[model samples]
Target: MEHRITLNAIAHIRSSFPEKFGIPRQGGLADTRGNIVFEPEYRDVQAFRGLEEYSHIWLVWEFSETLGRQWSPTVRPPRLGGNIRKGVFATRSPFRPNPIGLSCVRLEKVELDTPEGPVLHVLGADLLDGTPILDIKPYLPHVDSHPEAAGGFADRVKEYGLEVDFPRELGAEVTEEERRIICQLLAQDPRPSYQQDPARVYGMRYADLEVKFTVNHETVHVVKIIRSMPD
Candidate 1:
């Protein structure tokens, strides 16, 4: 077996969350949409020939932010209020032995003739913008779906949800569709478990908008929304 191997980026994900702050802890938890833009050398349409028939695909990507960081044997998960430590292999923490991450996203459409090459539109992705894609594979529900599968420690917080109170007047520039998406993103509760200060307003930079909100008990109140500076 090869102890070391080289991997190249086949594509990069373009999503609303450029930073890691507001990303969901797991994939398929939010309604966020993204585009998987292929790299120059791997832009051949033949590569994704039958991919359109599949409803979902697995994304093997790099943990770009933790590229140069060292891996720890144990990590404190935010779901557990960062108090208890679990083995790195037992958790989905980005800091790992291999900075490789995997996500299963619903494939919405396949644009074959775009000037930017063939692009795959996906939904329910929890990845950051410009996240490098290492590989892509079709998700076969016949074997992938496990209704009775146990999720281990993560199951305790599987039902994560928060009531979002987003006033319509906050971001008038945001389209109705965008407003709905923002509300869904906020419902996922982006704040760390330990930070429960109701007065401490937190800012989430998603796409072109800056969403400011505060958590008080079970509800998340949107305090402000503004157009952010372009990347």
Candidate 2:
């Protein structure tokens, strides 16, 4: 016999990312800030009581864009340099039998009693702005924190730092703090390892500036950054 499950969205994340290509492959990878605005119907101020006690929360959401009417059994992971294929069930690739995604985000603060309703201030969210959130649960450290947990296939993942050489013309417009944040973000190496063409310039928008960088081996070196013009 076949079983089925049904889920509903509780809120939607509001972030600066509008495209899938640039979203950090994993949530909380950016260490950048964003907001999780609950739907008006679920925005009861009382519902948030004691939520501030926890520093992080788990988000259950859908890969809404990855699904249609079909599914694939194999996928290429960017972590694997996007070359070799892997079984969909073994990887977090979005093209799964069920396109569900999970993320653990740090809770910065909770703003309550607002005219619009309660809002959750979150940090390090890799979710795109307006990504539908299916459910939220407080992270229980005693149960969730497992230092010995084995991360298969991803065990070889290496940490890297950014080598940004900001252009003088653009550097003058960006504040020192902004530069620091951008550098930290680029250090995570946002590009797929398979993509190693040095001549290509890749960019992503953070706050008010458009940051461009190139990858050489394991290094992500910043090339230029400009203040984004207002739309």
lDDT agreement with native, every candidate: 0.90, 0.79
lDDT digits (tens) for residues 129-221 of candidate 2? 788899889999999999999987877766556565656676677887777667767777777767779888998777667888887765666
**lDDT tens per residue, model 1, 159-179:** 667898988688586888788
TM-score of 1: 0.96
- In terms of lDDT, model 1 sits at 0.90
- Candidate 1 error regions (>4 Å): 229-231
| Alpha carbon deviation, residue 87, candidate 2 (Å) | 1.8
The model with the greatest TM-score is 1
